[model samples]
Target: MGAVNLYVTEQYLLLKTVDTLQQKYGFRTLFISDARDEFLLEKYDRRINHVICIRRKTFDWSNQLKQDIDSYLRKFYQQPQLFRGKETRFSIVYVSNLKPVDSWEHLSKTMRLKGRKNATVTTYFVDEYEGLEELGKLTNTIDKNDNWKMEALPPISEQERQMVYLEQKIVAIHQHNQRKFEEIFQFGKTKWTFVLIIINLIVFFLMETQGSSTNSLHLIDWGAKYNYAISEGEIWRFLTSMFLHIGIFHLMMNMIALYFLGEITEKIYGSKRFLFIYFLAGFTGGIASYATNDAVAAGASGAIFGLFGALLFFGLHYKELFFQTMGRSLLIIIGINIVFGLAVPQIDNGAHIGGLIGGFIASQIIHLPKKTEGTKQVVAIIGLITLMSAMFLYGSQQTSASENPQTMAAIAQEYVESERYAELIDWSTDRIDQGIEHEFVYFYRAVAYLETDRLDAAEDDLFRSIEINEDFAEAHYNLSVISERENEIGMALEHVRKAIELQPANEQFKQYEKELSQKSTSG
Candidate 1:
């Protein structure tokens, strides 16, 4: 063959190799040079991530080989770095028609050395210009001697037409991949994310303004997750508690997490799906907290964790994209949060776990944007309903005033706040009959008795409360009220003094003290 024909054969071989790898082996085009001599293609699966670099031109080992290798590494590193950091394992193939030079005897050894730094490199020289048995090793699909045969070089005009066809194919593949990426990661505007953040901020401000959120009384009033309240037919607490935060610090941490997680989740899943996942997960968390904990709990942590679960769902569908972008880091972050929650006693980890599971199930039910799987979605919906029903039933059965002092206290305060005196007395009487001897239970019952003009019963309960805790300032003040009603001026004076001594800053106690002193002097 003439020199011109030899060069044409090389060009034809490179084009043929590129087409076979893409059309047969499923490698997508990554980057192609403007001069049509060099290109990059990648094939990724659950098992491996691979990149192939091919060029029509050849270079001697002592010439542009080192520079070309550096350039490939630089470009290869950029692809991964754009989505995620450079922590994933890399395998690169350098292909050309150059025969091995005598000075390049140590090349394979050098590549193996670089493998220690988490990258493996291999080079193939297409000496025969027609076989791709070596390229098949990368995918393990092409057997030896199963070569792809090509026709002899055609006329110059025909060769030019073939080259143009190859160029168009490359451009089409590249454009398709870009569109797929955008469709997966950038589905819609972050409308619900911002709306949710604003709603949370408004609720937080409302809680802060209406009696401090830190107070247990205010927390229950604001619809914090109080198990006893939920058992009392207040099922809306599950949803309302998601909007009520415990404190300013809790609100800030959760809102920040919500902002970041919600932005991506809404864009990936669209606004409506994101909202469904968020609320369902939050309700799950609230119920989980109700079943596992008897304390007053409130925050957006559960809903934010649901957003994490949403991303996890996305990861299941797009494994390569997730790992390449935020998979490893996201897993590490979740692990750290779980560990931290376990280490800290105050953190509501039950809600976090419940929200995560709920978010995943909700995502399964909704599926991803522009995709549908009816069977999985139906199964997910059924599973969620069953799980939530079981949890709610278990939580209801677990509620016992005798077993949980916090629940007893919450029940007492809730009744007293609403001034349900008669109902308060009946509930406390039933609990007392069951041997529940909590101080708040006795104190609230005394308040109910006093309000209903049952002075003797009120006095008896007051003494019981004072006996349980001698520093019960409110109990002492109520006892003074009973004594004054009986016209025992000296007894009223003594109890009022003790109440003022216990709580010196209470204006109510001070004013009562003055009235009792005046009565004692008049008598």
Candidate 2:
């Protein structure tokens, strides 16, 4: 025969029916419900099917009732006589107070006595207020089917109830512990604190290795070399030199400042974003060092300046919490650093200014994942490209001019001062043949050539230095003195006028100008 089917209003009622049906008829049953009833159904059945909840106003009674009744009849009544006795073949029943169709009571009574012999279906209504009375009615109605049977069922055991309660408790405890662990880790993981510790360790190592008892590295000395190289066109040294310190105090102070500022900034921006800002600051410091000539620079003060820039940007961008906490202090720190960088003599103030500007620009550019993608990244790329191009052009010009005669003359002077005139002469002669155009180099080489009595080479370099920089007082003065030595008064007088015009206030030029005027008047 076909399987038995049962439906109920509540999950607990469904579970109770399933238990009774399994004991009395050895039939497995399924439970189904909406969210309100499904939770309890799932706790009991584990494999219960969940359906969407239908409210009284929205429920379509026609479709739902038809579907439920059709499912029941298909499972229980659509079978041959071999499975269900011939008397019971094609028989089905439903037990509920919910009427499946209009005039269900009249139809139930009519089907019992007059419907097709064994092919009839019966529905028994159970009164919600009277449970046993309803069951009696259902049993009596199904008795028309010759194979119908009924029996009492056992109640659920207490042991099964207690085991289900304990399992729920264990699941709740596990969920609580997992939430607590996540909260603890989230509180401990901060980027600034971690970065501060690393910077402190590095500073400690650098100080231990380089510090001495009396002569210590000073920021001024480091700043001086830092400034000079950058001013003279050695720009790459900017990033490298910021880390270098002249003494213990220099390293200690810078490290302390970095620790505080970097920590604060990192806390505001996250580790990844903070790192980008820091490195970009360092790169800007290099650019600043290159732009100024008199200032020597060193230290992470440039990057510190950038942190202030970030503070300003972030404060303005996020106004609620960060701005109120950090805005004032950042402004003060930046102001103090500016005063120090600018007022200190022998300090590459240019580098400090450049670094500050660079830091500000870098801060503007380093996309901090705050809100929108800021224009800082686009600006930074363009600025970096422009600076690199300028450096490249400057380097190329210097390299191409290295072969000029005036450049050779300057090189020979160094050799002469070091007492290597013989080597200088050989080098000068070799360079002369290369056809350099710098007047100073040619003049110096000519002098070296003259020292070995190569007078022609000395005159050529002196003339070239004059040609390259007409107002080159040194070259003209040298040429004039050389001419006087050779008793070439006319040549001496002519070059002296050019030298005096270039540097009228220069004492040597003044004396030459006066001497030449006297000689001209006397002649």
Candidate 3:
């Protein structure tokens, strides 16, 4: 086991251990300090950290040690390079302060070690390291104790991975709770947080009972944010949509975030400010969605992001607690979410970003529940929010697409399905005035026209829809139905065949094809 070349963290001097290992394998010692010192690196004038690379003599360390070692470690990592071909070089390299990401599979292209023949690199994190696991992966993390008491190390176990995760969670929780003892006693209540979670859960249950949570129809009827609906003066959709969710996983994820972030933020800002920020952020998210997206969106993601923003604001106000305890973790969480939003498909990231910004603004407006309050800063905050609101309202009223074409289309289709042809036509005409001339809008309008015995108008709208989108399967199928109704069997056959070809898996289209074929044969 000693010859295998991995070491657990130790507290005392390893001189005797190093001497024993040195007899079997040649190794070099490099002591690195993660602490900062007021020294500059040579002529670069760059501030140097407390790191020192020692061989027989000392080497001054740059502040950017990770950037320095990622390349330096490449000499030890497996590669078809000059160093790998060399013999009589390093057999064992004992590095202190633990160079990170050696085992993370994602870093293989860069961190993969292909060192000199039979070379092994053993690493350790020391007492002064004072590291954060959230920054990166680390091994040997089961804390024997916080003090520097020397003891024999236990064998590494698989449970250490779970311990690492638990430790990260603990650190995250600790960051949230690093207030002074007096402040902890009067922690903000989470009445609003529980209320919000319960309301979301109830709404999700209602959604599951009706149809799939992911179903656009179910979501729209349940007051999910639809820009067209909002423009029609259904402003309540903004608040209602925030409580709705698309699936169990979506609901679970947001609720978990709320359980953690919401409680802390609400406690920090008080119930009133927390509630205000949550709803306002949700409203802002709705506005962003209306402006940018043409789909029905439902989730508490915006409000959850509001909580994150609120925490950041708290950190900013309490500079000491934030910088020393919370800032890195908060920034890391935000960065991760932002990256995930960019990478994942079907995520309502507009809502997340919009809510983050909106919540931050609200945090400034509504002062934290602290002894020291800034009256001037508060007034400035209100003025900024008011100015932003006025601009958004003016722009929304002016922009034609802000009326929500997709919302109109979804509503129109619902009306058509229910045989409310007059209402469908009215809504369709109203949306057209708002500049919503999308192919779905045209197609739904045509369906209403056909149902209301306006054949000529129906034919015109269908042709326009098909012209706008050549590959719209529903449009082609509907055109075939219109042709058959008008006794044009050949045209019906052509259109139905096109529909079937576009969506071969659609059984309805296949049935329509068979019906059209029979009609052509009879004619």
Q: What would the TM-scores of all predictions be? A: 0.72, 0.37, 0.59
User: Model 1 residue 382 lDDT?
Assistant: 98
Q: Model 2 residue 146 lDDT?
A: 30
**Residue range with the least summed lDDT across 10 consecutive positions in model 1:** 81-90
- Which of the two, 1 or 2, has more lDDT? 1
Question: Which residue segments of model 1 deviate by more than 4 Å?
Answer: 1-13, 33-38, 55-64, 71-105, 108-118, 123-159, 401-403, 406-435, 443-523
Which RMSD does model 1 reach against the true structure?
6.8
Candidate with best TM-score = 1
lDDT by residue (1-523, candidate 2, tens digit) is 1111122222223233333333433332222233322211101112211111111111135466446545655544332211222233222233343444543444334242233364444433332334335444433333333332323322234324533453344334435644643442232235654565465457546544654211212332223233323434665565556565545576677677777767766755667667777767666655554444323345666666666676667666654333224544566677787788678764555555555665556656664443445476787769866864574455344444443233234345666665656776666555545454555555556566666765666777777766787777777777777787787878888888777787777887888768877876787
Indicate the residue-level lDDT of 244 in model 3.
86
- Per-residue lDDT tens digits for candidate 1, residues 1-523, read 6666566666665776788779976777767788777877766644545567777656666346666667766776556432233322333444455644646534423263243454556655553444445555544523244545445557766766776787788778888988998998899789888888899899888878877877776787888888766887899999999998878888888888998899889989988899999999999988888777777889888889998999999999998778767787789889999999999978989899999999999999998988899998999999999988988888887875434776577667777887888889998997787676778889999999988899999999999988999999989899989999999878887898898899999999899889888877877
Q: lDDT, candidate 3, residue 510? A: 92
- Winner by lDDT between candidate 3 and candidate 1: 1
